[model samples]
Target: MELYRKTLTSATWWSLVIFNLLTFSSCKNQPESTVPSWKIKLIANSTSHVTYLVDLERAIDHILRVQLVQVPVFKGKELIVLQNIMALLDNFNPLYKYKKGKANIKNINRFIKSQTEVSQEYFKGLANDDEFATENYIGDDYIGCLGSQSGLRGFNCSLWNLFHYWTVQSSFSPELFQPGAVLWTLHGYVHHFMNCSECYLNFWFYVQEHQIEDVKTHDEEILWLWRAHNYFNRKLAGDVTEDPWFPKKQFPEDKYCRKCRWKGKWQNDKVLKYLKNIYSSISEVVGLINKEEEP
Candidate 1:
């Protein structure tokens, strides 16, 4: 009877998971791809509508594709790459904290710790599996685009959202108040999961070239990533993989922050303030900031 009860509970849990995924995929502006839109929101923002981190939600193949751009960077380096991969998944990305619905687990920090271990075990297993390969990965061509299709933003769009959200929470929470945590986490995630050789090397070189780890404060952390992202955007300005609708440019462009620029240079202080509000832990724009700054 106990075994039967456990089986029934497992079935029920997965049913809810699928139902929730379907509901989110049905969202109005979902990109034209197999992955659902709510999944997009789920990965993008933890403070988003769905409470828990859908950590094991996407299939392993899909998750790896999102970070496959890191593969080439790890090409020649074996031991160091393995160590960093472990650190990234185990320490930095505590991503699977939403394992609930059956029991009322009060200790969230404890729950997060347990769930994170399970996720890291799974991540390592997927990375080592010999069967997975770039040719068969569900990536750019797999999630094909048809000229500005919203549903086809793929991993790049999802990654951008995740990084922005990271900045917001890392700045606000005392427990997670580390300055350059996200940058290191991102690098570690790429080294282990991504398979895209060229993109992998470029990002590795780019961040290393810019010394992303040197950021000492939360404000610099946020702005540093924003700057790096803009530089990458300029590189991919006319690339075939870019989404047509979401044209790449210097983020928080001049139109959004006229005061953020002087001549051709960005005013980092003003830009930091503007970004803080947009990516705050809560939806501060509507409830906190005045209308004059909503743009």
Candidate 2:
């Protein structure tokens, strides 16, 4: 009888221990600091305005044709995703009323192809047999040049703009965040299209290591990119490829978001809201960009 009682007591104790362990593991995922620890002072002297997106957009177009246009080796779904990226961005087409329907990748690419017209000689002297050279001469301009020196404010910077723009634009969509739409497309693009073999691996590993797939809401998606990109900015702060004009730093610092900074950590809520405004509707962004462009 004593043996039976002892066995029952031991079983109850083990069950309680197992239950506590499972609960702790589950809560480990609940809101923790997304950034690596570092002390950063906010810079408030300069503002990179919305028109920067205009330059960024131009740079992106140039980069795609130059560094990102190699024939992708991806098969099936990922290949399709890469092709349809412009279509995905179609949600923002109506925002720029002055030039409607211009952002569509297919429409613009087709027009360029018509103007320059692809020829065997075009790729004859290039590094990749399938290199796509555009009539606009977008080579190494970081997608599209706005008086930017050849490599300054190029591919990497433009890529950051593209990511931020998509999240902001997509966040307002009727679909709200389509789970992995933006992230998956980006993953596929970098993995298959980027020129440098080493770059693709680094980006791929970072995405896998971070919980990008765990992003269930569009808000989560935006914050995740913000966190990830700021990390990128911090790491690349002094690298040679870093743009001279746009020095990498912890973005949206005290100047950008006065409320985001506390004694040490960021107020994640304020940061998310601030990003949404920065990457807000097409009309708001286009209006500001146009205003900046005016004489």
Candidate 1 weakest lDDT stretch, 10 residues: 1-10
Enumerate clash totals for all models, in the order shown. 9, 9
Question: TM-score for all predictions?
Answer: 0.51, 0.60
The runs of at least 3 residues in candidate 1 whose Cα sits more than 4 Å from the true structure, single-residue gaps closed, are: 1-147, 199-205, 281-295
lDDT of 2 at 272: 83
- Write down the TM-score for model 2: 0.60
Question: lDDT by residue for model 1 over 1-295, one digit each (tens)?
Answer: 0100011122222223222211222225545654444433333333322111221212223444344333443332322333333332333242323232112112222343333133444444445444433322222231111223444444344454456556655676635446766655454444334332222334444544566447887778888778776776787676554544546677766656777889988888888877876554322111112334457
lDDT of each: 0.43, 0.46
